[model samples]
Target: MNSTLWIVRVVLAVVFLASGTAMLTLSRARMIARLGAWIEAVPIGAVRLLGALEVLAAIGLVVPPLVGIAPMLAAAAASGVFLVMVGAIVLHAREREYLQVVMNLALAAMAVFATWGQLAS
Candidate 1:
């Protein structure tokens, strides 16, 4: 169980970090090209805010636990990731992007399991 949790944590950390970096560094046009037309609908500031949150959560998910400092923060970060996935699911559903909805659901499930496992441990 511990091994599984660690693996999930590392994978999710990478996922969030990469995505957050892209959002923070990319131009609006680039983001729209990469993400979809939906990117054009959202304000750039909102996207950046989401990116900032993701990056913070990614760090929270890994750093505290690894450093043996306030490890419970990992669970909290997973919870935040779950919320983000929920929002992603909703947005994808609204856009009729069923594939993305499925992807987000899987990510959300991973977040839930990570949160539960970390908190339980």
Candidate 2:
């Protein structure tokens, strides 16, 4: 079970880090091209802020635990992920992007699991 939690942590960390970096680096036009026109509905600054928060959440998921400092941060990070995913799900649903909503649901489930596991441990 501990191993499973660790795997979840690592996977979430890597995925969010990469995703946030892309969001931070990509221009509005490029993001629209790659991610679809849905991105244009969101302000670029808000996108960047979300990206930054994601990067922090990614770090908070693993680093504190690994360092034996404030391990509770992992739970907090997972909670944050879950919250962000909720927003994403709403946005995707509003846009009628069912596929993206599905993906968001999966991530939210994972985040919830991670949060529970972290708190349990």
Models 1 onward score TM values of 0.96, 0.94
Clash count for each candidate, listed in order shown? 0, 0
Q: Residue by residue across 12-60, what tens digits does model 1's lDDT show? A: 8988998888899999988887776667667899999999999998999
- lDDT of predicted model 1: 0.90
| Candidate 2: RMSD to truth | 1.1
lDDT of 1 at 30: 88
Q: Give the TM-score of candidate 2.
A: 0.94
**Per-residue lDDT of model 2, residues 51-82, tens digit only:** 89999999999999899999999999999999
Candidate 1 residue-wise lDDT at 33: 79
In model 2, the Cα lDDT at residue 95 comes to 95
Candidates' RMSD to native: 0.9, 1.1
